[model samples]
Target: MHRIFEFDDIIRAVLQHVESSATDLVNVAMTCSRLAGPALDILWSRQSSLARLIMCLPQDTWEGKVEGCCRDYIVRLSREPTPIEWEHLRANASRVRRLVSIDGFTDAPKLPRGPVLRRRTDGIGSALDLFRPILRPDVIGHVLKRLFEQFPPATLFPNLCELHFEAVFGLLERSSKFWLLRQFISPGLQALRFDITGIPTHEVEQLFAALPTEAHGLRQLSVSAGNGTAALTVPPSLGKLPKLIRLAIFAIDVSLTRQMITNIQQARCLQTLKLNLCGTSCDASGIPLELPSLKTLYLSEGSLSQCTHFLRQVTTRQLSRINISYRGSASPAEVTAFVESLSTSCQTFEHLERIYVVDKSDHPDYLLVIPLHSEIFRPLFKFKRLSSVKFIGIGNFELDDRFLKDVPIAWPSIQELKFISWKRRAFYSVTFTAMMSLAFRCRSLQTLHLTVDATQSTTIPRAPDGTEALWPTQTALRNLHLGYSRVSKVARVPYFLAEVFPTLWSFKFYERYLRNCAADIDLRLALEKAHSQLGALRNSPYENSDKLWENDSDDSGT
Candidate 1:
């Protein structure tokens, strides 16, 4: 018994690294009765599919194995498929705490939606594949209904904590499906993820309305319109989930934004909200929604101004993190206005921690420059608590050294910083002293990414006594990625970088030159090899290895 417990501990350790750990535990359960109970308990704790578990039953349980179809199915019902003789399933059913429905992949040349797909099983495999639940829409609906009917009760999975269904709305919205679902809406259920693609808005609304009132423990709900333009209707019942904490909506029509906002406003304990292409129609009312507990909000792909408009309506003073992304070309003025509005609204948030701004425009000719030194970005500097900031521009954006010098004062807590520009030259050359000033001030800085010119010849920054100015050594910085600007001496660049960031274990020089030059190519390759060598040297405990540095220089032929 002690050995069994010890082996169970090993299984727990293995589970942390592998998603198939439950399956592995199940295999171990088959070895002995002593191990079976505990192993099965863990194995059946979270099930991605009920069919997969059902298939584990003996061949006798299968009604009749017929050959023609890709997979097998229960043609005849026996004893209404009760919990008799199936000891393994009956014993472990109570352990199934999660149910996730797998999504189907339509192959090339999508078949027009109809019964035409049910007749064509030319390349479809056998019934054993039903566990994956990826079948013709009609077949999926039928099999799921049959399986749900055969499912025992909440007693089988008494502690089910989460229910996740992906692209399985056909089965979920079936007239009889709610009765089966009601069995699993135990008080222990804390999360619900439903992806209702192609399902009409009315059906989705009905599904939400059917949710059990006893869902007090439910804290997280993520729903997305699967793959189509179906604007999912937000059921007022969503606002009624007592402990609801996080909500995410994706690819929903703009027309429903008003109802969605109202639904979110009612969730008392909501902490995180994510909107991805969720709205089309912008609400002109700009009504304020009070959400004191909300801490994080992410917006992507929707109308940039509309998203900001929604943000303007929220009074989440405790909000700490904000991520906003625009997929298409957005005017700089509009983007700047959004930032300015956010900065003004959250000016009093002393706990603001991270801000990530991304412009995902694909147009090469378009460039959106943000002058950090100008009044447009002045409001952003008010967040003194910022730890991580990422600015990914649409094309190119200039970042002057004068503006960078104040980064430490603006966000002294900054640890991870990324400024990505798509232009050939986006950052003006800064004296090594000015760059080191940032390192000196921001002691906790670990990851830094920027692009700049390094080719200009200038006097080394020194003190009045003519001694080279020294900055405090930054021990936390481990990764540095700098855009390759022209360097007067290519060989000296790495040494300069090594001096600036002595603790770096990963250093990458990125140069985006339109027309590639052979000498430039050679220089980059050599620098890459040198960076690897430096990384290895830094990782090594033995520091006094002049021979290793010599060997690296020799290899680079410098």
Candidate 2:
């Protein structure tokens, strides 16, 4: 949160950081109705990413020209649309050149056949629909050819360090596709994101063949696969990107063919890697994956049997953070073993600070489950450098009483803690109590995040006699967040946190359940009250909470 100033010049800085804070923008708008348009202007100007704009797809925009659609497409159009309408429309062709963008994308049968409009979203489509104009097949291919042919020749911005193509994977394989991609991205491209949805097999191969072995300048590159079955080959050139820092890729088995692994081995400078082999992936036999500089790694899919091989093969001393996600099914015990073995093998990765093992509970097919085994800290207590932890969505039925025992011994350095359970009774569960006990046990604990399982029904607990257990003693906690699946009354949250974490500074409390989900103001008063309490905690006990709300919020003395 940022303070507001009456003078106009002060806001320019606040706007920079709060661009994504929609609620704060609304409050600023109400302060002066005139501020609404300008504030929106600042926020919408950022719809520059292709992904955000893709969300606007399949939906129509500005019927014909730029209008006030609150969708992503509008954000893609120039936030600074000149006043002269004819001139704006007239320059549509040239602006495409200057900005390196094409308004409409591929076409589908449902979309109208002619020229498309480019407002944000005044039409009827989900955020995902608005990409229709861009998803059109030929249009997508043309955008790719156009990008490669022109970017290398025109990129002049010194401040620009990265180039992100939102749905680049939309383009299919072609003869010169790899060459063209290399032509545009080879040297200057630092950050690249391609969405492979409808791509074909050969094209996938060509894309991989185009990986630049000499990409010494590459830093962060992400290639995603949207909701489509059209699989592509895994490019071996991927591992060869020179000085590659962070890479996020989703590929199928065909790309995992033997030779690509050799290329992967050649890539030794990688730091952070995220790989998702969602569907059937071929055995990654003899694929070279020797990443000595790697630090953080994330993988989705692959059995413990295969994962153990991959982890054992990587001889890197810097590997510290590991996030293993089990999408379809997996056993909690097996997952626990997989993680424990990783710690034992990657001994040089002594800096390992955090580990995240995500499992989906209800998928009966993968009847294998991670036990309500937080107390089964037996596998993890070995890592002396471990710290932060996150459990995304195990239910109450999966956990039991002895789960939280002996957790800190594995990594006495632990400080910040985040626990998210999808189980009901989390607030009242022994597991929750164990979590709290563990939170207080960590002498170095500074930031603690206790989020109830959002998928469950709501149940706020009260003390045995009427008051609720505030929390483990909050004296050591600096940042504490207690969130409900849905927003409750705002007043209830501030009182709870105030009692629990007396020194807490930043708080995000939800309370929209009582009213229309989108328009609820249940927690409005509570936020201001908390802020004043914060002010009081700083030792100014005399300040009035009501007055504090008037000074910062849009509410006037009236």
| lDDT, model 2, position 148 | 32
Model 1 ranges with Cα > 4 A deviation: 3-35, 60-87, 101-143, 152-155, 167-184, 196-203, 210-212, 252-259, 278-281, 285-287, 361-375, 422-433, 457-466, 511-513, 517-558
CA lDDT, candidate 2, residue 375: 44
CA lDDT of every candidate? 0.57, 0.46
Taking the tens digit of each residue's C-alpha lDDT, what string does model 1 give over 278-396? 54566555556677778887777765676667667666778888877766655667667777777645636587788777765455343344443234555778888989877665435
Q: Estimate each model's TM-score.
A: 0.75, 0.54
Residue 121 lDDT (model 2): 34
Candidate with the greatest lDDT versus the true structure:
1
Please identify model 2 stretches exceeding 4 Å from their true place: 1-160, 166-183, 195-216, 224-236, 252-262, 279-289, 301-315, 360-370, 374-376, 395-405, 418-421, 424-437, 446-474, 478-501, 504-558
